[model samples]
Target: MTDSLQNLVSPEEWQARIDLAAAYRLVALYGWDDLIFTHISIKIPGTEHFLINPYGMMFEEITASSLVKINLSGEKVSESPYPVNPAGFTIHSCVHAARHDAQCVMHTHSINGVSVSAQKNGVLPLSQQSFFVLSSLAYHDYEGVALLEDEKPRLVHDLGDKRFLMLRNHGLLTVGSSVAEAFLGMYIFEATCMIQVRAQSGGGELVLIPQKILDMAPAQITQVTLGMGGSLAWPALLRKLDRVNPGYRS
Candidate 1:
């Protein structure tokens, strides 16, 4: 790491690196990784820059040092031997710029996520986990690959005031003030999609939650963690990641 990188890497940044890398490992372990397609990015400590996985690295191969630093404009800031996907950063940059509270943003193209996004109804409130997502979910129509600068405004508009975004015919996205929150949101969002897929496969009557009950879900889930929020799930997830792929932290 260079002196500038050393200065940028605070205790918080170290923790973020570990958490973000673990998330990538866990996503790969769960078979949710799309080779090198999806991305999970975290804002660097004390700067407008963010850390993203190297363009060509598999999710399981991502380490703290393997991550690349890039500005919101998608310019690489550090002397990384690895290249970055500026087009991949397009969606992430929009969220980072629009949502100041969003310290981390995760995007995935899992089979389940794509299946759910392709559905006409999007996310249905069939499971308890669905409530947590449906309460705060936003939907963005797919405009092919997310590369055009013009897509940013529409993406921002669709993602407005929501933490979870379902990119229609594309995949899923979640944002949080911390890496943990973003990961947890993706977890629930993914779970909801998986459940919906399996349920539809059975061709059985779906038990959808009432809209009134769904409306109360966000507050209720928040209350369970006492406003510390997804940090409750973060520790346990780290423990799981450590057992499966401990190299990510290093």
Candidate 2:
């Protein structure tokens, strides 16, 4: 099943599969996977077609050729031995339809992320990490496991043009023009939530970043990364993945 996929797909799509597969493994590496529940999807460049994980496979077990290619309608468009998850289909398809710029969409159910989502205020600007999230964050109230097709519009509306979404009482989602960008977004997002959780556990007065600094976070981040955004860190992350989980490109 895996060996023949390379011959079947364009080089561009093969690369997309490899990168998306790497993302799935990295999510597992970072302890964000939820037993095949959450998903990370990426569109094949210049097409409505996208790749998602083979349903029921653990993230670490995913390989580039193992990803299932499908259209926005949740129907498989290529040959694969695995089925697609309906819940994953429901969430990712709408985001892809609404935001063409979102080439990749990643979702997670990490403890810290869910913990913050369960909070009423959601993603407070208590740390520097939180600023990036707060600047472009939106919240969507969980509508009982994300299975219904009717929930798609509401999900798209709440997401709007934001890069980060806190699925209230559920988890976190981030979208980007590339898998690297989306992974970096999730890194910052999870880190922010972890910081928030740790700070709250201290039981002391949390000093919020002043509104002035918070307002400048977008520029500050651009300056810090020299406008590289996720591309700056993606190579290093891939190198890390190569060392730890090297078969993602298979």
Q: What TM-score would each prediction reach against the true structure? A: 0.94, 0.97
lDDT of 2 by residue, 1-250 (tens): 4674788789999999989999999999999999988999999997889899999899998999999999988789978889987677789999999999899999999999999999999999887788888889999998998889999999999999999999999999999999999999999999999999999999999999999888897788788875427998888988999998898888
lDDT of each: 0.87, 0.91
Best by TM-score: 2
- Residue pairs with clashing backbones, model 2: none
Who wins the lDDT comparison?
2
lDDT of 2: 0.91
User: Which residue pairs show collisions in model 1?
Assistant: none
Q: How would you encode candidate 1's per-residue C-alpha lDDT over 143-206 as one tens digit per residue?
A: 9998899999999999998989999999999999888888888888999999999999999898
Q: Which 10-residue window of candidate 1 scores lowest in summed lDDT?
A: 1-10
